[model samples]
Target: MVKKGRPDKRSKTRSQAAGGGGGALPSGELIGPFDRTLLYLAVFLTGAAIMMIEVLGTRILGPFYGVGLFVWSSLISVTLIALALGYYLGGIAADRAKRFQLSHGIALAALATALIPVFKTPVLLQTNALGVRAGAFTSALLLFSVPLTLLAMVGPRVIKLCTSRLESVGRSAGSVYAFSTVGSVLGTLVLGFFLLPMMGTRTILYGVSVGLLVLAAVLALYERARRNTLGLLVLPFVSLAIAGLLFFLGGDRLPSTPGFTTVYEAQSIYGRVRVVDESERQIRWLLSDSSTIGAIDLRTGEPEFPYLYILEALPRFHPRGRSALLIGLGAGQLPKLLGRYGIETDSIEIDPEVARAAKDYFGFNHPGRLILGDARYEVRRLRKKYDFIIHDCFSRGVVPAHLLSVEMLQDLRSLLNDGGILALNFYGYAEGPQALPAAAVAKTIEAVFPFHRVFVSSLQTELTDHVFFASTEPVEFKADKVDIAPSPLGKLMLDNLFRYEHKISSDQGFVITDDFNPLDSMQVRKAEIYRHQVLSDISADLLAR
Candidate 1:
């Protein structure tokens, strides 16, 4: 059971008389000085690490399964449980020792922290079910339980060590809490806003591992080098090697034919963006989830070309691409394609680094009106109505909370012209050759649009992402409506997409929510859980093949 606060002697005595406080802690003087410092550092580091583990965890899990709610919840819940266990166990460990030794405990705890970078991928890769159920989530909780639980002990255990008298106990606790919280504030600002996006995930993991290992070594300074010393040296190198291998070996690095010139490959703020040479048909901008949002074709590269699906689909449905808006600008592919087609696309993309990568590697330059901000805010501010709009922005690792909310969709609706078409893409779960999530999304779209039809993108299997296109008027795929010479590049892409044989399931459903439009909130039967399992099986199957 989770318990809190140090009770006064009088209260303890009264409770004992009432047969409820027989094991009450005896009042002691404030804890020692060295002990307090150790306690403070431990808690401070613990808080920072917790934030790192929680935030970075999402990024680590994202590539396999888009950062959906189920993944986020799994990460959150596991971290919480780790903290809870750490708190309870730390107190017991401290009380058993009578007087706390900062060095040994701190060293032990830091060593545990350092181990994270080492075992992270292996633990994940080796996890049974590859995570078909809550097993993955549960195991993750257990893996980190050792260090986090120990870290949790700092507050209460330190109070026990530092409190010299009953009167000063409360004051001492507050001081520690304040300092620790301050550490948390700095941790969030640095890691979330600055360090993570810039440094990238694997590098950051290595840095954290080094800091922790160093902390442990510093604690053991006075004594002769322990056997663990060699371990400290070797482990960091091992971590470096593993991270390096994973980085280089990552993604679909293999060739994707001749004309599709893939320009840049970097893990950036918006997952991974690849600018492709569609043999000058357009620069196809691809995001991590393999979604293309923007393209630029033609030698002039001015945002004004009249072309195929986008051209015909928009105007034919009582809407058109005069003031076209796109949420994701991968390699400026869609923008390039649209600009060549004369659409005058307005793009709102979150990651500037991705834009830079696009420029450097994928021919991503400013396409028409560029809005470098969150799409939701940009859409809210825009006064002109859009004939065509694409909701390509997703939760950084999953569907962003703001984007999924009814308010945001309503915002998008307001910006569209009468009978305008809006396309939304999401990665969700489906079963039995039927795209359930597509059906659910269709239901949500129907609620917003007056008339709509759901189109399922061909995934290799039942459990794959589905795209939905909804409009104020009905939509049908018309080949003749498309203008321009069908570029070899677009044709190649179309060919690959053609292999995907997914049809939208009419019977599948979802609870339409105005408040919490959470995808992947289901823990046990989570999207990620099923996906990882499938991925592992695929990996094994491919290896055997």
Candidate 2:
């Protein structure tokens, strides 16, 4: 029988062993309603924070390392490893250390999160020399491991704190994990759909860090109040001050280029888009991530890239062609030029920002229809046929593998008229390790259309852009039939257009399909080479900004 007005000895011992918490009943409810609420909130926030950082990590590392297979693999691998380690360590600490609390882990994670924007640039620059695979993995480990590990610890600790009786351990674990997983789902959706498109990378990161700090503060205050420890009342404020100071030291600033002025810069759903002008050179360029998608001569008001001229002259291959379809409207130069030729052109662009920048900064005024969507999906939706189709979506040192698959080529072929010609642009080495991507593309095109011709932008057999013209009928270029007025550079390109014609053997590459496409793996070395060149040409500070 229990004594009146006296605590049971077993209950007193259990409370003391739990380090200032009251004894739990058989139901395993060791915490009061207030304590349970704070614990669940902490778990929820940390779970959300982990996912937020994972998504934001891609944006932070993309400009330098690219948002490709290797980078994503590295980020995912690091996250899993850190979480595993955190779970193992947190379980041990929770069981052994009487003074350890969930608030401590949250506070530490807040500090680690604040350090990311501060040290990311230097860390990435250092790791970049390690090459793509190793560099991307190492950078992810250094920048994200500490915070993800700390945040991951919250889950196990919450589970331990909530489970007092061994009999109810299963129920407690399930409930705690349910809350955490739900938080992760919400975090991913909110970040991808809402936060990233609306705010810059740095701003979103700072906001996440601040949010974690606030959660940590609330948890710490609650813990202190529950323990009635007046001496530790200042701990939460001290952590906030230190985290705020770190954030202040790591503010984001745009880096200045020596000879160019940035006309506009913004983070889009696709990537970082920027318009930069070289006044002395009288040139302007539209950049997406680390790749220059389009450039124009400010003085002559003509597309500067030689590849654009090649595409413009493509219609010469089909003299009777009146209506055309253009894929990947970079600067809208090709369609604008086609409109000038009195040919009705319809264009498809995946990124809205690219289209906006084309109109606002690149003087892209297309008389034809501009459809905003992915070419792979948009091509299937078109009911009308065209005389000519141009595919130019290759960028960022890699092609969209889905666009180059056998199925996609078949779809593009289906959208063409009887005598229609399809032109595809690709960038890679003509012969060597990097030649596989280009060769595979050639093989895939041949799989759909029997008649095709390949043309290189430069005479050199090294890394360059190759344009392919494919059709059911024989693909031919009639120079005498071309009547459009050409810029001096365009004239130069036309003079040597046939000289750039080359061929890649079908045996050199396997056909790419939606089911089995190894293009990402095949082009790793090529991507690394291209990214290194971009890094050498542009300031690292500029890319970081």
Candidate 3:
């Protein structure tokens, strides 16, 4: 068997053929230069398509499945596994089929690439219906994986087929891999930055579909100008029509219950941004990077700060309200709430797409100054000081490790006022009736600021991960007129959602540090409770019918 990096003899033959070392093509039986060139082009396109499919597949499934470190790790693992299998199979198949063999393999992958978008939704449905959460990811691999793996087979098969002069195959194989890699790099950058947002999901998918189908048709026609060639030509036309029909008349997805509606949905480089507005109320829920950041009730038009109460209490508890810094500006809730009380605010939210989104959909008015970059780096650069430095950076399912680093916390303290406060939100067993590693973060927070106080934002009903607030000053730990609380009339104005209690009071053993943040450990422990919370919080019953 040929090793992965080192070229086998067939590749050497192909290189010699390309270099004009082994004379010209010997008429009809020998492979023509155009044929070889076309074959290489086919290989390149298929390789590029394989990569883009992985990206697109993740985007398509991510809104439902999530795109956290867990999801990414799963997708990447499955892709490498598929590639390994492809490498193995391609070698075996090349050895067996010498005739229409290599040509057939690459052409088939092109055809399979065309088929991806059409089957995407149905596969999603099948996975959903299976209701197999344990293998939720493995199930994803089971479905779209076959086509993707098949697509990976194109390179080796093409290399094996095109070589007649054994000596040149080495350079030929390298050239093939190079073209394929270049195609992949180009595909990733273009699709991620330009295609997904500007063109729309349907356009991007169908565009790839059309390209792949055209390549397949080219191969079929190049093989023989028969009815099948004509038939292959018609496939893209039919695909276009079907894809168009799906795009234009795509029916709404009925929710499990009624009143919940997806007011807006878009793919962003960070993840999927979904703005779900409950019809019964003016509450707009923002899902950035797959986690719920804030829900603003449009009727009240005031940001409900469950955490605001906690943040406001800090100044009273700590008294130094000179400067304030915030990270993870979702809906600009924390910063917005701070601004309302006449406190100075500097906010950083990573995604510019998200920053714009916060304005258009999430009701997050642009802060006086909004910085777009990783919070860790931003904090290090800003030599300014704050009375209350808030580290509220939380993304769905996982938190950014940098934000929790001891180094970052220390830097944040450097800019902190002498009697300053640092409040960090951690979600523990919020669902109900479970053990959580929520204490780990508290321990970590304590490690950084040993003198700070921690409190739960909500009613403190269970062992849930809640807000662990740290302050240089000793907190009074009382909720007297918390800064963002509702008045009697304002409280009356809120939907029941605004009133649900948040869990904040618990001392888990470990804490998130520059070194040890066992989020997955916390997740596994709190899975059942978390699931119940999701079932209750985002229950199908609350969504659009």
**Counted clashes in each candidate structure:** 36, 0, 24
Better of 1 and 2 by lDDT: 2
Weakest 10 consecutive residues of candidate 2 by summed lDDT: 20-29
User: On residues 1-545, what C-alpha lDDT tens digit does candidate 1 reach at each position?
Assistant: 33567567776654333321111123432224664675577567656765675676655554444455555677778777866776676667655653333344544555565555456555655554444335447545645666666556655655554555556668867876776677667776778778866765656655664555454445334211322333334433443455445445442342244455555555565554444455535544344532233445445443221122332234333323566887866555565555544677778778776667656654656456767887767777889888788776643234554575556667788888876778676655555423444466666666677665433343454444454567776765554655644345444434454354345545665634656554544322434445544343233221111
Full-model lDDT for every candidate: 0.54, 0.80, 0.60
Candidate 1: 10-residue stretch with minimal lDDT = 536-545
The candidate scoring highest on TM-score is 2
Window of ten residues with lowest summed lDDT in model 3: 19-28
C-alpha TM-score for every candidate: 0.68, 0.91, 0.78
Compose the digit string of candidate 3's lDDT tens values, residues 1-545. 87888978986655544433211122113466887888788778877777777787666555555555445666777778888888778766655543333334444554454455455555555554433243346645864577567767767766754665566578768877888888888888888878876754545656675576566656656654422234444544454455446545543342333656776666566766667776676677776533566677777756544655555444445443645787887777666555644577788888776677678875666345688988877877787777777777765355565566566777777887776778777665554334345555556666678565555545554533365567665655433544555433333423232244343344446555656665664464343344344435553333211
Point out where model 2 deviates above 4 Å: 1-29, 231-233, 242-253, 278-282
Off by over 4 Å in 1: 1-42, 64-66, 98-100, 132-135, 209-320, 394-397, 401-406, 426-437, 458-483, 488-513, 516-518, 522-545
- lDDT rank order: 2, 3, 1
lDDT for position 96 in model 2 = 64
